[model samples]
Target: MRTLRRSRSRPWPLGEPTSPDGQISTVDLLLVRAALHAGATPGQAVTALHDRGGVLDTTARRIAAGEDLPALALDPACPGGPLVRALAVAEVAGAAAGPVLDGLVDGVVRAAELDRLVRTRSAQARLVARMLTTLPVVGAVGIAVFDTGARTFLTGPGGLVLVVVAGLLVVVASWWMRHLVASVGRAVRDVDPLVVAMRRIGRPAPGSVGVPPTPGEGLPTVEALELLAVSLAAGMPLVEAMGLVARLGPPAVRGQLRRAADGLRAGLPPFEAFPEGLAEAADVIDISRRWGAPAVASLRLLADDLGRRAAAASEAAAEQLSVRLVFPTTLLLVPAFGLLVVVPLVVSAFSGFRLGP
Candidate 1:
């Protein structure tokens, strides 16, 4: 396995670390993935990763000493982090190391991209917020200094009400705009890559039908599909492939898949036996069967498509945020500043004069 060069001053990579804690880096995980692809067992992979040592050394030593890496991953106190967790999930599915590790790499890359998108959007929103806040302060200061009637207005009942209303508007508009931007971030966070992949699956081939995906079941559809593709690539029969994926998959989806598997056992065709909402998946499998094309290749293409779409969507949301900001500025902030700041200064400037006299 290739090890990254470590300097005495900075043992880690120069760029942003994957985790908030500086201990484990994405580079380390990529190295592990490479080792796994090259036929190293999980334990062996970690042990080799240890020599490039930092925070990983302790965890690697344990695995090297005959500890089960996947089991260690399940223990929260263990040093094994997300990489181990991904490995554990793959191990449970009895998936080939290749596809599992490949998926892990892709997942980490996608997550990093999403984080950057979110951070950029948040920074832009904060900048706008700062500028909006500055408006009221600057207006108030200028009015106080330049307008002699400011005192008269400041002492009046109407002026007091205007000031109070303006304050409330500024505060409320700021809060509302912040909430809107935060909600977008939360939505982006809640978007599961697996679910995204499944949603982007091409429509069922013409003249074919499959059951709609189980409502509220929220099963891991892409994981199931990827596992199925892996099995098929390994030359397993379709029935056995479905059975294996169903058996080792997550408990939530196990029963759903088992029902499908049972249907297959009873000699039902792929379109019927595959779980609900898997019509496109069935079609892909059927195509693979006919032309000897690799279903996993199609899966890889789908994953790439999902990443592109997600990135594009997030970018659009950020751009739309800038446009939406105009609403609160015009309706709340601008009116409040005019009432509380401009009106007082203008009225106060003529307070000493009596026109009817």
Candidate 2:
């Protein structure tokens, strides 16, 4: 068995194997695929990364010339590392590499969509934050240096201190808010996860709508689904597919699926055999497969859902930021506005009244 497994993983026969914060541009992947289909070597494909004759293109050339393409595909830094890993596994299992690549392309498209949502939303938040930041400075300058009635009052020692303190607080608050928003954005993004959803793993589901929160949490589901899809495509039974993933998928979620596969083979209820979440997922996949839904297509849908979930997480983080901004904004802007705009008007009114008397 070990010898057979080793032989199967023996690097892909092809010469080569192998983010924005979330937009999906197929131009690069498409370019690579086109090159490969046209019989270009891995090195050749990478070198053809088009007008981008810089470090990236150079890196691709060097890797193709020097490193083992199959081995490098598993590296996190590799472009489409996860997809390459999937293709490698599919090749080993005797599945059609072309079909697997198609599945991978679908997954990448979904991931890109998720990235786009996160990036755009964060940018909007950043723009809003930036606009607010300039408020105190503009207001301060207007009152302190421009308004004649307020010139004397603002230039006084007491007024200068108020202006200075307000300016400092506003600056600090704006900086802190920007940092907080960025931190929140980073928090939502997770590195590639291992476990994937089952129903969605093998069967290509339809395009999903609306991204959900915490894409990382759903990745185990995506991993599981992708494994099942590949195994099923290769003609493995449901239990067999589950067992295969338990062995090959990320260690974090593997054991549970392994136990479930074992129990399932022994005639236990499918739902009772696996871990809670995985079991539910596995059960759904089992039912759907039996219902005649193509495993790959269904799994594709699952993958899309997971992508949406990631977008949702980013959105949630962005919403939380707006709430967080409230405290600092009130502390800085309100006081600055009142001190700059309201105070002068009140004082000027009183001064006019006294003169009339």
Residue-by-residue lDDT tens digits, candidate 2, 1-357: 000000011111111110222222356556656775786655455556645552235346546576544455434334433444454455445665555545555655655454466556556556667767777667767765666666666677866776777777776776667666655444433322322332224342222211221222225455666766787778877777777666554334554567777887997766677666554465666687579775566665665565466556666775666676777678777786677666765665565565433
Q: Give the local distance difference test score of model 1.
A: 0.58
Stretches of model 1 off by over 4 angstroms after superposition: 1-24, 34-40, 43-82, 93-99, 106-126, 141-157, 183-279, 289-294
lDDT of 2 at 87: 46
Model 1 agreement with the true structure over 16-114: per-residue lDDT tens digits: 111233335567777877788788876677777776766567778888787776566534334534345445445544556655666655665665566
After superposition on all CA atoms, what RMSD does each candidate show versus the true structure?
Answer: 9.2, 11.0
Worst 10 residues of 1 by lDDT: 1-10
Give the whole-model CA lDDT for all candidates, comma-separated: 0.58, 0.54
